[model samples]
Target chain A: MAAFYSFMAVLALVFIAAIGAGSAGMYTLFGVAIPYVALLVFLAGFIYRIVYWAKSPVPFSIATTGGQQKSLPWIKNSPWDNPYTVTGTVIRMILEVVTFRSLFRNTKIDLRVDNVKVVYGSAKFLWLFALIFHMAFFTILIRHMRLFLDPVPACIQKIEFLDSILQVGIPTLYQTDLLILVGLTFLLLRRIVDVKVNYISLAQDYFPLFLLLGIAISGIYMRYFIKADVISIKELTMGLLSFKPALPEKALETTFFVHLFLVSCLLAYFPFSKLMHLAGVFLSPTRNLPNNTRRQHYTNPWNDPAIKPHSYAAYEDDFREKMIEAGLPVEKEA
Target chain B: MYHAKYIIPALLVFLAVVTFPFWAKGKAVYRVELKLPANQTECIEDTETMRTSHMQILDHWRDKVVREGERVYTNAKGVKYSMSLTNTCMSCHSDKEKFCDKCHNSVGVAPYCWNCHLTTPKGGK
Candidate 1:
């Protein structure tokens, strides 16, 4: 991961320099072509990983449980905490996915006080921040769908209309943009402020956050401060989507280029970066598979030439004489 | 029982990688109609009429475009609608550099809207 991140950082710097130099062609290939390829790589690689994990044989039952298992209903039971059955597991999974219950329950202690009480408050700020960042990022993403889709979906339009309903500025106030920035800031700040987290956190963590912050700030600058030519920008964007790369009469300005560059960097960085998590989520086996193996045994279907079954009969044939000599209970005496 | 409790959530989190792109929403575009009042159009004739009417329309356009959803009214034919600033603005200002400069200069807005396109027609001053 560190090596991968380092490579990305170097690549980002190089890409940024190319943009800074005003090489539109380079930017197009790096930002546009690379992103498309990355998406493909991410999709293919992610499915491959998930399928590999699913194919893996877990010969033993190894479910990580924090609470009691459902052995007998008449006996004391912790259904949600310790799910022994599939239905119970689904409930637990829901909580884990939606609320991040496990993260919420995490606790960390500090040595600030000599006789310090174990501070047992919810320590899911990271989880909360993650949830906020992801939701906001996707909200912004879905909202951006207006650029790619023709006759935009009513849901997206409704969301777009609602997002700026506050009518805060000259342009409508997109809460998602602000939310994403704020979320990214909090995430970055957390890594910086927490000594332990900071120590463990590599430049990979910092790089993406900074890169994202850069993208967000540049975008905001173009929208509110730099005042880009919306028509030209849209034209150029639409043209690119259509594969007819015509630079508008006054299609893009420096600010627009900067915004575009940052976005391109993000696109190029995605496949190799943790942002690949976008594709990684679906390929996960733990989330996709049903926990019904115990009810229905799952035998390995693959053919293998190497087979040595230590059946009870075989063991008896080998050791029954010794067992009988030692006067041990045996099904058949040798 | 053991498999259901822990393995699934971990698997879900692990598979989170797969969930994004299929549902990944792309760029969205919304079309809005900017209207020109009839009375305002009637009052303005050719270039001067376009210029004067455009300036009036611009004041309305700027505010609405910025505030978003806030409508601007001009007594063009004594009827109101979304401001038709684009048509009027582009009619004369089609030569982006010369016309855009006249207004942007006064407003003190060095907007970076012209970098990618030609400011003037192929050598036409």
Candidate 2:
């Protein structure tokens, strides 16, 4: 049901773009204004979300340690997994961010053949597909700079060369294009096919996946099938980048508008959705904080300096006469 | 925020990276101007089709000539021409640097046909 709704939502966006750009010929709205608005929202919302997370106080050293912590000199410790120092913690965070170390360690529970025992199995496919999706998406984003940058950078040119090195078709199909589709398909399938995952999947989870698939498919269709005028598209993009905001002399295909509109939707939806994980990962207390609670004091952020600690001896001294009258044992004579 | 020292710098870096193109191309307006073939009012196909699918048409010609051993192509108007980029396409649009490379370079598309084919037409036509 969640997947169906998300699919319909993406289809509705495609229709909106098609009608707006194709039928009504609102090129300025779809091509220029919406993208600019989406970009602004993305930037502002992203920073706001990050700052909101930053404002929340983490009152404890809550790093989720996976191995032996720093202790006796003779005992070996897993510094990467159970970091006790700032340097070790930094390395751990780097590994976590770059390689998705936590996802790499994901496991699945399975029943034994006899149905008498539970077994833990390595579930690496999710990690692999997620990594592929992210890497391909990032490379595609970088490649798109070709449209926006004037006198395109050498590095961007080199990346485009490497991407289409296979040179399969007339315009030379990109490898990342194929990889992104494959990754998204697998991820979507896993959510639908896996009963356990499907049970937990919400509309928001499926919405982004469908929205991204819509963007990727529309982009691929425009590039390979429709062969939208690249020069004109670049003209429009460059115009927007420079704030000149002029449509090209040549009319762009509706597919281009669909692609642009979906991308705009993605940007606008990013910060408010689960996609904020892009920034939230950096702020995760479990992954970012050092596991040094045993060696150093961690003062709670919510602690009030005005509050004084009362001693048990003082409490007993105050209650001695009352305790004697009630026939309760006193710590000292009244 | 307790870690404003780290978070603020990271946010700034993110902003810079995301808006790289805006700052990188400061005050420079870029547009590709191809030198259309002189004295030629019509191409084999309409201007729109050629602008979009010229590479595809060229690739098709390449495969037909090299793989199928067919050289002649008949257009919609019944005009017969050799299926050769050097002998045919570059004949009128002769200045490869000015006509072809202008748009290609602007768009960052480095078509590898020039690696094997001569940039100038054969025998300097």
Candidate 3:
């Protein structure tokens, strides 16, 4: 149901782009105005959110460690996973940022059908899908440099060549296009099929996936089927970059507008939504800060920086009445 | 599960970004000056089509003539011409700097054509 609403929302945008707006108006709006607006919003919102996060100082290191910490000299330590030094932290950050190291260590528990016992096993599918999705998406974004560039750079051409090396079709299908689609499909499927995930899933969780799927589908259509006007697209794209957007003289196909509009929506939505994790992941203390709390004293830097987390004393206060009734030790005989 | 106070300001920013088309109009005017081909009365395709689909036509020519060795292009108007960029399109529009770079730079695009085409050199060589 969450996915359905998200899908409908994206569909509405597509309708607006593909049908409501005239080719000329839509071209100017999608090609120029929305992109500009989206980029501005993305930057502003991202900065604001980062500032908000940064202002909240962590009184404790609170860095989650998955392996052995730097301790006694004789004992071996997993420095990359549980860092005590800057170099260890950098390596950890690189691995986490590039490969999702923490998530890679996630184990899934299942009930054995033969007996009533529970079993734990490796579940690498999620990690694999995430890795494929991000890597392919990044590659695709870089490959688009060819369109924006005049005298297309050698690197972009090389990337383009590498992307379509399989050359399965006449126009040479991009491998990233297929990989992104497959990745998104698996992610959405997990939200629907996985019981725990489905239970906690909200409309917000599904919207980005649906929006991305819409953008990817429309993009593939424009590339392979309709083959929209490339020069017109470049003209619009370059015009946007140069801040001199003129309406395209040649009408590009409607599907291209659909793709552009969905992409614009994504850019606009990014900063305000869960997608902002792209920035947040870098700032998250749990992932970024070195686990050196054992060696350093980290008192609250600012008195009001972070709202004081609930303490054991506070928890006991709220449950004191119940504790007395259950004959457990009570605070002030409450 | 988060603070409700920031919603209005956040929404204002979102509205501004999403409705940028309506607001961004006529703020800064940018003009592009096209250097009309020096000696040509006609282009290979129609003027309007050339403005939009010139790259597509050029790409088609690239694949057909350069790759497939087909040296003829019968355009939509049924005019057949030898499919050679240097002999046909650039012959009259030989002033690549004045003619091509004008629009390309205005829009900030880098068409890789010149990398292989050599921009034809200066002094009509």
Candidate 4:
């Protein structure tokens, strides 16, 4: 039901963009104003969320250690898994962010041998799909800089070259374009097919996937099938970047509007949604902090300086008369 | 903000990266203006179709000529032309720099057609 609703929501967005921008010819609304507004909201909301998380004090060295701790000179420790120093923690974070190390280590339990034996098996498919999706998405994002940047940079050109190295189609089929679709399909399928994952999934989980798939499909449709005017599209994007927005003289393909509108929706919905994981991954305590609780003392941020601890002797001194009246044992004679 | 020292710098870097185009091309606006051939009034196809799908047509022509051994291309108006990039297409769009390279360079599209076919100069052969 959640997936159904999310799919409908994405469909509704496509229709809205198709009608509002394509049919109505509200070029300014979809082409210029919405993009700016979405960008503003994305940046502001992103900063707000990051600051909110940053302000909340993590008072413990609660790194999720998967290996031996840094102790006893003779004992070996897995520095990458259970980091004890700042340098080791940094390396661990790089691995977590770049490779999704934790997700790569993900496992699934299964019942076997007439349900008498339990087996743990590596679930690497999710990791592989997720990596493919993220890497392709990142490359595509960078590839889009060509549209935004006037006199496109050589590095971006090189990326574009590498992406279209296959040269299979007329416009040069980008490998990432296909990979992104495959990744999204596998990810959405995992959520739907896996009963455990499906049971735990919410509208949020399905919504972004659908939204992204919508964006990717629309973009691919525009590029491959519709063959949107790349020159005019670049002009519009460049205009937006320069804060001097203008609709192209020729009407753009409806798919272009749908793609842009979906992108705008993603940007606007990003900070508030699970998509904030892009930033949250960097600040995750388990991945970012060092596993050096034994080596270093941690001061709880919630501790109050005014709340002094009462010694056992002081406590007894205060309750001596009460203890004697109650005929309870006293440390000193009264 | 417990680790303002690290978090603040990281946020700044993110902002810089996202907004690179704004500063990188500060106050500069460029529009690609292709120099159309003076003598030719019409291309093989209409302007809109050519703008969007010229590459597709060229690819189709290439496949038809090389794979199927068919070299003649008949357009919508029943005008037959040789399926030759150099002798037909470049015969009119001779100035590769002004006509093709303007938008291509601006959009950073490096078409490999020139890698094999010799580019025609400004004047027709």
- The prediction achieving the highest lDDT against the true structure is 2
- Name the candidate, 1 or 3, with the larger lDDT value: 3
How far residue A15's Cα lies from its native spot in candidate 1, in Å, is: 7.2
Model 1 agreement with the true structure over A11-98: per-residue lDDT tens digits: 5654564565365545455435654565556555654554554556545444555665555558886766666576776787677666
Residue pairs clashing, model 4: none
Per-model TM values vs. the true structure: 0.64, 0.94, 0.70, 0.94
lDDT of 1: 0.58
After superposition, the stretches of candidate 4 with alpha carbons farther than 4 Å from their true spots are A308-334, B121-125
Looking at model 4 chain A, which ten-residue stretch has the lowest summed lDDT? A294-303
Q: Please write out the lDDT profile of model 2 over residues A216-310, one tens digit for every residue.
A: 99999988898888889988888888889889998999999999999999999999999999999889999888899877898898999897767
| True interface contacts retained by model 2 | 0.76
- Taking chain B only, the TM-score of every model is 0.29, 0.90, 0.67, 0.88
Q: Which stretches of candidate 2 lie over 4 Å from their true place?
A: A113-116, A308-334, B26-28, B122-125
Listed for each candidate, the true contacts retained, as a fraction, are: 0.01, 0.76, 0.01, 0.67
Clashing pairs in 2: none
The global C-alpha lDDT for each of the candidates, from Candidate 1 onward, is 0.58, 0.90, 0.75, 0.90
List clashing residue pairs in candidate 3.
A149-B110, A150-B109, A150-B110, A150-B111, A151-B110, A151-B111, A151-B112
DockQ for every model comes to: 0.06, 0.69, 0.10, 0.65
Supply the TM-score for candidate 4.
0.94
Question: Model 3 over residues A143-194: C-alpha lDDT tens digits?
Answer: 7765565545677777887888786654568999999999999999999999
